[model samples]
Target: MQTEPNSNPNGQDVLLPPDGDDVPRVQDLDLNLLKAFHAVYVEKNVGRAALRLGMTQPSVSHALSRLRLVFRDALFVRTPGGVEATPRAQRLAGSIDRVLRILQDMLDEGAQFCAATSRRVFRLHMSDFAESAFLPTLMRELDTRAPGVVIETHHIEDSQFNMAIESGRIDFALGHFPHASSHFHFSELLQERYVLLMARRVARRLELDEHFTLGLNAPDGLHFIAVTSHPQATELLERYGLTSRVRLAVPNFMVVPAILSRCDYALIVPHTVARAFSTPGDSAMFEIDDASTWPVNAYWHRRFDADPGHRWLRGLLMELFRIGAREPFDSWLGAPLDLAPDSAHNA
Candidate 1:
């Protein structure tokens, strides 16, 4: 027997059996012991791991001895300045980390969200247009409510969201995902229409503004730019027999206005986004349709429905886009709702 001084489960000092002589049974596994292993795996130093876990270095070593005997492998070995995990330990760490998180969430059930001091990092999927239309207000809300919380926005399309969310890649997505899987929860944010954007001078010089308003076929000389992220953007143009008129295509929406400023090319964009770029002096906006508007929704995995943080964030988005912030947002987008939707509706 090694006879190392270690604290037993009853909080009494006891001599532990020689490592590998007495293996820990399944019932012997304790949360603290697992926590010690995770800490050591992450910190790579027993002393640092002990400090992180608020335990003495001897306690961490004792825990490691029992774990190594049970696993029948030296899970970690002393390297130059710290310990290195064996292949088996590396494989075990991921499962243990996930279990710990799930257990923590279970313990945090019914807890109130403290947004003021939260350091939670939220990941989101948003398009360039959605970012332009939504992020400013969201950032302002974060700045005022939870300055420490971090936001990461990824421009992933809806098709890959199922895998991304399942792998814990994104916390939620904000956009038009009408046919998402049943395992996801969705709430309406707002409805938005797409619009045509072109330089005001060019519109007048080419007599394009007059022709477009009259619902007449545009001249053959007109050319367009397409944003590839919304395939519907191109399809809608194709519906109008404007596919052949597209001279340039790109994935991002941010550069469209700059391109329109310098060129005679026209691009289709969401009305909210168009509002940001289409002032009366710069760009002209044209209403596409009122009856064909698409709803931009907030989507998340249904499993997070009861998570306090998820609920808080979801509520914040719903409030910002749906209830509290709706009127001002609509006013900013261009006009009142009952009169006529004055933006493009396809994208």
Candidate 2:
């Protein structure tokens, strides 16, 4: 191994070899050699790989020779028809493809986004409530603007979401997430305050006004329906001394409306969800006076902060739901519900 000159400014020890080292470090590995390896692995023939790479056969051969020397293996063996990749070459193919794709995406970021032509797939992590409230409008916009784009949604727990975003399994997470780490980026999309949801008949029977107050004590004989995932909602219930009042605990907000319809239980949910569940004669929504407003944000890894496709998606969401936009989201929901002026405070 040939050692290069130490160029450390902070007096930290750094050991590296020159580019001609027998066993190259990651920094010393030639990108051309890796590209050659990928081409060879895909084409299975040196002549064809050279053609695909827009290089001469001898140049590709030389590049393959360097790759073999660096990897210490004959990555490809000659065959009668063409060539076959060795076990080592086969193992390197997947990683090399992923690297090429990342590079391509980075290159594409510099170009303007053409939604009409681009076929990008965006993966989102959202709760059931967010899906119910936002997906309809989001899909409509996608259909009109980016007909070729695909959207995949996953309902993942917050505990495992960081890993999912880091691994690129999820492109964006839209919901009330806690503070993110330095490796992640977040922007507030909407702010939602919790509200009480109950059947219209139940509300009428209890003599609850439009602005019903829970008072300092849990309402007598009130069976609370709790969403298992919302700790803040549960905490509010506990603060109002309503924990013991919980009779049924459900996994998500999807079934809360249905559960409240047949039963007389009161559910604490976001005002957006309350409005979504409330119908003219089925359910009624009321604002909680002392409720703390939680923010619904779009979270992504810091790595994608500058990605054009990701930025476009985030921009579209912000345009539609940010504090002030041309159209009211209530119109998108096709309901005459009145939204609080300060409901979606920007953050």
Error of 2 at 167 (Å): 3.0
Candidate that scores best on TM-score: 2
Write candidate 2's Cα lDDT for 29-109 as tens digits.
677988988888888787888899999988987787666656665667777767788787788889989998998888776
Model 2: residue 305 alpha-carbon error in angstroms: 3.0
Q: Report the alpha-carbon TM-score of model 1 versus the true structure.
A: 0.60
Where model 2 places Cα greater than 4 Å from the true spot, the runs are 1-110, 157-159, 217-221, 324-331, 336-347
- TM-score of predicted structure 2: 0.61
* Candidate 1 lowest-lDDT run of ten: 338-347
TM-score of each: 0.60, 0.61
Task: Give the clashing residue pairs of candidate 2, or none.
Answer: none
Clashes of each: 2, 0
- The residue-level lDDT of candidate 2 at 253 comes to 82
Candidate 1 achieves a global lDDT of 0.74
